[model samples]
Target chain A: MARVQLENVTKRYDDVTAVEDVSMEIEDGEFVTFVGPSGCGKSTTMETVAGLTKPTEGRVYIGDDDVTTLAPKDRGVAMVFQNIALFPHMDVYDNISFGLRLRTFSDDEIRKRVEQAAEIVQLEGMLDRMPDEMSGGQRQRVAIARAIVRNPDVFLMDEPLANLDAKLRVHMRTELQRLHRELETTIIYVTHDQAEAMTMSDRIAILDGGELQQIAPPLTCYNEPTNRFVAGFIGSPSMNFLEGELIEGGLRTENFDVELDPGAVPGVGVGDDVTLGVRPEDVHLAEHADSLADHTAHIEARTDVLEPMGDEVFVYLLLAEEVQGSMEEDPASSPNQLLMSVTPDTEIHEDQAVDVVLDRSKVHLFETATGDALVHGLTDRSDQESGPTATEAE
Target chain B: MSDRHRTDGGETRTDVLTESHEAELDRGPFQRWVDDSIKNPQKVYRAMFYVAAIFFLVTTLFPFYWLLMVALTPEGQLQDIIFTPNGFNPGAFVEVFQTIPFHWYVFNSFVIATASTIVVLIIGSLAGYAFGRLEFPGKVPLLLLVLVISFFPPAAFFIPLNDLFNTSFFFLEPITGDGTLYNTPGAMVLPLSAIFMPLAIFILTTFYSQIPEGLEDAARVEGTTRLGALFRVIIPLSAPGVATAGVLTFIAVYNEFFFSFLMTDGQPESWAPLLEGIIAYQGQYEVLYHLMAAASIIGVIPVAILVIVAQEKIVSGLTAGALKE
Candidate 1:
């Protein structure tokens, strides 16, 4: 297994910079996902590491060797694509043995390895069946078997489970994790689905506008995002933002005035414009405010929408809509009203008036103009007052 | 729709069948048929489809029947040829094999059509792969130019081609150093391959493009070079397109009469394609219509057999795109 490093990697196509100065270090045998929206350079960064695309600048290192100029075949890496690209003319056995045959392995070794890979993917007794004779999941297993037989140092999967049906995608996601654990090979996966990234990765590197936004564990990125974007992107239903100007107490927007103890947060905050960020799960209803008593800020609001998600309910609370309408409207301010998430059993309904509490220990504050997190650990939830671990906040 | 009287599981099975029968009895015979048609339109559609198909089939096969009737008629009895043949003279087809070294011309057509078809498939697939997959400086304009050339009338190139064959270097000419490639089987093969290449390339490029772009990339990442991936994956997947191109090129080359007639200099003994040889039956003094019809029928037998053998290859069951399901 090999550790991969990209130092100041940048890729450009004509005038457009697809990947801009992305530098990440992935430990050996670790599963790291480069997750982002489409066109966010996650695939481009993976391609650069795979030697499919040369970086316009900087170097790519795999196990201490420079692979920036080498062909993809010489990199000792195997890739699985979103569309399971099994050879249509070849049967399962032939497809799996393709890499071994290409490397010119002996007949005995090829057969042994093919059987081993088939057993790993649970594809026994189907070796002689052509690709068209099998189901979609079976074809993808052959694709995985093809990669498995190669026994490469690193595996690069670009949305390998994107084409599967929803139920099958989840099943294969768990299967991939188990495979990685058993094989102990370094895997660099790229996906646009944040949920997959969060569930399957040891560490996730979130990208936006061709820039690496944050690189941390999924929970770390979720609880403490480095900036406004990471906070909103990492969590389900996304984190909510209450935009306002920083004042003597805390952040003062059109309708709500959140009070913050001065000694609780470092750096001068008066007259500095800021935005209050909190996740949907952190918002508490009045009946559920028992655990949020310490420094919670309570606000009375009218519920506008209720989305029942079986396990939990997303209640969109409208607070001071007439007051928010008085200011020159901003797009980020559209979510100015809070979206409080509660357990499905909670007695919440649309158009119901209730008092919602913002968990003071779970609140985040960011610069209004720059979208950078200005004050992390403002509430000292861990009681260490350590602030965010490093410059990345998480 | 109710199963309230059901007690045991075995009785439930019989009750379900009886209920379906009662449901069927609820509608009139025509209404039941219409309801079945609504549920599955394919069976009804096939009935009307075969009727139309048979009508067109008869319109096409009637000419072959007329050819057989005239070929069996007695010599020069023009009036009775269509109405009645002299007898079931099965020996008349032997004249087509005897006249003007017909076997040699048949062999020439076979060699030229088969060789030209092989050459066309090779050149077409290579060019098709490049056109469909690769990015080059002037790919679009070059493909457009090939398409435009395919539209050009074949007869329009006779003058320049005839001069180029008879007057250019020996590379263009035969080894005899006469600078004339006339009446050589290789002469017809070259022009036929050139004439049929554009359509073959078009068909193949379309087929290759429909395949997902991920196959090559996946192969490359799995440790195969681009060209290696093409041979191992892409070319094998393009078998249907190759067969289509080969069959079409073979048929067009087989039926070619203009250039085949032009280069042979009217000497059927030295050089003639099947089409030109059929035309040779009309002599300078009197036209032998009966012999010509007999030769025409014999000439198509080889290609008809080719169709029967290659018919299944034209239907593709490729599964590359199904991986995304």
Candidate 2:
């Protein structure tokens, strides 16, 4: 196992910068996933790390060796492509043993290692089957087997589960986690699915527009995201953003008001426009006559749609006044929609108005113009006191 | 009770039968005839199919039939106009060997053609793989050069190549040292190889390019060098394409006339090309029709067998990657 580090690695394709100044360190035996939408350079970063594509600038290191100039085969890293990429002409056993044979191992040694890999992947019975004879999941297992037989320092997989059906993908996800634990090798996997990243990665690295957004442990990233993008991207039914102004005592909306802690905003005095973000699960619903004093913000919106998932219900809501404006404008471009996840026992009906409470502790505030998160002022002051002095920092 | 039941039962039964008969008549004789035709249309189709098959067979095989008939006829009976053969004899086959050094020419032609075919397959596949996969300086320009050479007429290069082969120029000696290639098979073989090399390279290159890039990447990750992957993975996968190139090259070399005719004129005694004697021996005094026909038939057998054996490979190689699974 090896620690892989990218030192300000950049890749440029003519005028387009496919990966721009990506720098991250993967610890030895750590499972780090690079997650992003399509064309976000996550795959490009993985390819750069695998030494398949040479960076236009900067360097890559595996352990203490600089591998930027080395050929891919000499880099001592194994990559499983999204398509599995098994040699169609070779059987499963031969495919697994290919790298060992290339290294000029003895026939007996090659056979032993290949069988060990096959047993690990549970593919012993399929040793003589061609890739076409195998199902999608089996083909993926062969790909994993191929990588495992090499016993490389690092394993790089690019969206390896994207081609499988949903049920098979879940099964393989757990199997991969088990494999990672058993092998304890450094694995750098790339996927666009956030759920997969959240479930499988020890630490998740999010990327967008060729820039690294955040890299942290899964729960840390979920609870305390670095910015609006992270906060919105990490959660399912994504966090809802409501436009409001920071008034004298609380955030103000058209029909409702939110009370913020006095020390929440330090730099700004009043009348600062900020976008408030609250996750779907964090929003609590109450009956119209109930007292919502402890809750910071309260809004009454008519339920537009109800999706009954097994554990929770997703209630899509819209303000009555906002609905009138949306109807006047284009019916499709409305922005007043909100999705709230409530307990399965809660009763909600379409077109019925209900009071929703936003929890202040879980809410995130961002600047309207820059989209930068506004951390609570009390925590920032405490952190500043404990932080390094200028000369010591330098 | 029996009298009452008999009163209207017979009349009702007759009325129902009459109604069914009237409905069948209304459907018309044409409809009935169409139904019968649909049930047994294969008979008419089979008859027409047989007739077409017979026409195609006669058209295709008549030339070969005439060639065999001429080959078996006596030289003295060449002028006979009757369709029926007076007698059969193998005198022409023996006479063909007696008049010329036929065995020597056969040996020369076989050596030249087989050697050229092997050379083309090896060099062509290597060049094709390089052109298809490798990234080096002037690659695109070199590819364009190959395409240009493939389209250029072989006759255009004859004079320059002849001069190069016949005489010492610049720093190098003539190709065969003291003896020029003017009356040797090398003159024909070398030039013909150069002419067909581009075709071999083009076909194999196109086939190699259709293989997925992921397979090569997998090979690279498996610790195989680029060249090793090419030999062990890419070449084996492209067997059909290589076979196609070999077959086409063999056919072209086997049938080449102008180069063999021009180069081996002075030494007709050494010319073993299958069709060479047919033209060379067609003089005013002795036409030698029987011997020419027999030689032509013998020459066609190897090529026909090769084409039949390699037909499947050719089709698959040409159609690879054109359709999705």
Judging by DockQ against the true structure, name the best candidate.
2
Off by over 4 Å in 1: A7-17, A51-61, A64-71, A260-269, A285-297, A300-315, A321-336, A342-357, A380-394, B1-51, B74-79, B134-139, B168-180, B265-271, B279-289, B316-325
Candidate 1: which pairs clash?
Answer: none
What DockQ does every candidate get?
0.37, 0.41
| Model 2, residue A328: C-alpha shift (Å) | 14
- TM values, all candidates: 0.82, 0.83
TM-score of chain B of 2: 0.73
lDDT of 1 by residue, A69-154 (tens): 99889998988888788877678898888888888789999999999999999999999998889877888888888987888989
What is the RMSD, in Å, between candidate 2 and the native fold over all Cα? 6.9
Which tens-of-lDDT digit does each residue in A93-132 have in candidate 2?
A: 8889888888878999999999999999999888999787
RMSD of each: 7.4, 6.9
CAPRI rating of model 2 = acceptable
Q: List candidate 2 stretches off by more than 4 Å.
A: A253-256, A261-273, A287-294, A320-335, A376-394, B1-57, B80-86, B90-107, B118-148, B169-175, B179-186, B265-272, B277-284, B312-325
The candidates' interface RMSDs, in order, read 2.7, 3.4
